[model samples]
Target: MADIVNLRMARKARARKLKEAEAEANRARFGRPKAERLKMERELERAARIHEGHRRETPGEEA
Candidate 1:
């Protein structure tokens, strides 16, 4: 004979597992160190500056 299980407890446990899995996935997708994020931002800013420097026509000036 199979052992009896509490339905409510089983349901709660399942929900907890699903939630934990989603949290793990979110962490992997978006978790980054502060220093790494800052470095990425700096690199993007530098690239943008270089791009703007190469442009002959400014946005406000008429050719």
Candidate 2:
């Protein structure tokens, strides 16, 4: 004889798995600390400013 599975139990198990996956995704998307994020933003801005400073202006280009 073959073994039988409960339909309700299987459905509940699937729902639990989906919920866990959603939670994991949410954590990954919002896991960084606010200070760390702000520091990264500041670093990017500083690098951009430095790059612009190093750019050479052409004689024909208008300021």
Candidate 3:
């Protein structure tokens, strides 16, 4: 025979789990300082620019 489960408890558990996951994600996204975020964004842009500078031009075409 299979075990019987309480549907109300199961539903509350699922909701709680979802809320916790959302809170964790929010913490990661909003926990950083503004200056640190700006620094990271600038670094990423600089790296992208450096990468773009290293690309090769195709034959008979301008880069």
lDDT (CA) per prediction: 0.94, 0.90, 0.91
lDDT of 3 at 21: 99
TM-score of candidate 3 versus the correct structure, residues matched by position: 0.63
User: Could you tell which candidate, 1 or 2, scores higher by lDDT?
Assistant: 1
Every model's TM-score? 0.54, 0.51, 0.63
lDDT of 3 at 28: 81
Residue 7's lDDT in candidate 1:
100
User: Candidate 2 lDDT, tens digit per residue, 1-60?
Assistant: 988999999999999999999999988667889988788889999998898788798457
Superposed model 3: Cα runs more than 4 Å off: 47-63
lDDT score, candidate 1, position 47: 100
Model 3 lDDT per residue over 1-63, tens place: 988999999999999999999999999888899999899899999998898788796457875
* Cα shift from native, residue 19, model 2 (Å): 0.2
TM-score of candidate 1 versus the correct structure, residues matched by position: 0.54
* TM-score sort, best first: 3, 1, 2
